[model samples]
Target: MTDKRIIKSSKVLVTGGAGFIGSNLVDRLLEQGNQVVCLDNFATGKRENLDLALQNKNFTLVEGDIRNYEDCVRAVKGCDYVLHQAALGSVPRSIKDPITSTDVNIGGFVKMLFAAKEEGVKRFVYAASSSTYGDSTNMPKVEDIIGNPLSPYAITKYANEVYAQNFTDTYGIETIGLRYFNVFGRRQDPNGAYAAVIPKFVMQLMAHESPIINGDGTFSRDFTYIENVIQANQLAAIVSYDNIKELQVGSKSVFNVAYGERTDLNQLFNILKKNLSEFDYKISDVNVIYGENRAGDIPHSLANIDKGKNILGYNPEYCIQRGLEEACKWYWENL
Candidate 1:
């Protein structure tokens, strides 16, 4: 448990602002009386996701790509803080095209880092991935101890962590990295070949279709809520410089943003079915289909969130069930 820190009124840039998680962060920032600018190229980000945010007077959307230095420079201007969430986000997507993943996740990240540093931004907080824990077999992953990356996507994300470690020495900028677990909630895309399990399952179950599990359903994850992730970002932005330094591992200060627990795919299926049943009883009986395990996927992932609690004062408000219930309601009404 940690004491909460309030975000002050400031100009902030959200790199992938038109996407699922980025859009949510934009909305929350606007409500907190902050000036928010969202930068997106619409490559994987959707235009419709910014509908509500576009309506906010405090929100400014920058139509640009992180891959371009000019665009990054343009977006980072006059920003007090940067929330860098832009990247090609899926393991399968990366395996299919490692070049694109490397270009965006690695190259694009360095571009943003320089942009923030050039503009003298107060802090640079970006999303990291739990996939960095690859091949470790650690029950509850800690920040300092990590294993070799399993896939191209994981490799790229871990590379981001490595670069961020040298920011203070290389660029004199404060940086915080959030190693996010399987984050799910409202606005998270439920389509595409790389769609996450929760929303995809919800959408399929709503349509009375059986979900195809990628593995035998034994693979587990820490399935964190979007609100908790949002809080993590908010808290990270305002973290004290000394505290930020204290959380450093090999020069990078990263925290695992998760629910601090685990849920296997089979349990996830049943949980979604149970939650959706309250909305429509008929959907409860929908069966799940099991398939072969994915090539680069790990068997289990859980996080040790003590570092975040002790340092950033993060205390997650929603559990998996509560998040699933809310997500079900949103999908029922919006989908």
Candidate 2:
């Protein structure tokens, strides 16, 4: 395994800085004494997410859309590294409006990459998705073995991996892609139609309402915590290309950023209910409604995170139970 190196004394640009993952990353970066510039249009990102960040003198919020070339250019100026987290994330949302998703995800990705290249940023790190593992039924997903994409969102993420590689090969710009699994934690919006299952369930239970499961509650996922994702990003930004090249497949590489375990929906519900019940006893009695299985969703997901551990020194600190405990506490206090 590689030794961990924290990113400090540098300037970093986080594209979706006001979003859940981006804002969290921004906070950690700032804590490490790095100058952080956040580029977000507040489309899905919340202004409150960056409240603590706005207080820091080292943090700058650039209100901009990634789709516009000028906005991307303006964000990348004087940055040493680019953390590309700006993208429309939901599979259903992309299916409904593929054009807008494509324009923002694919089109905007290229613009940011171009801007990073022009600015001579040391490295470009992006958020890839586990949805890219579309039809593959592998027990543990490895970096190189991916099947056909199942949704428009998945296609866009896979295209990002391809584009990052192309940019690295053709322009010599360094890039790393962190394929995030079912990430959940604080600040995750639970009210949206495309809300993630964990936070959505948390909200329902808090309201003494039944949380709906899309399947028989047998389908499982490698639910990664936000803190683990922050560690992966910091490692990806600082790790040398030469050290990573020794382990990576090509000029650019992607690593699975997950907790390396799976938890079915039933177990997840029980855990959340149990955790939240500490604050509100009635939550323990909250029932769950099982619905039809979501189309395009796989039965199980488990990440073989050996690549990240060996190369980037990514050691995830939170498991499903631990993460849920933390998440439940945050929701109880904040919501």
**Alpha carbon lDDT at 291, candidate 1:** 93
Per-residue C-alpha lDDT of model 2 across residues 93-170, encoded as one tens digit per residue: 998888999999999999999999999999999999999999897779988878888888999999999999999889
Per-model C-alpha lDDT, please? 0.90, 0.92
Per-model C-alpha RMSD:
1.6, 1.7
Best model number under lDDT: 2
TM-score of 2: 0.97
TM-score for all models, in order of appearance: 0.97, 0.97
- Over 66-158, each residue of candidate 1 has an lDDT whose tens digit, in order, gives 999999999888999999999999999989999999999999999999889989999999999999998997679988888888899999999
- Counting clashing residue pairs in each candidate, in order, gives 0, 0
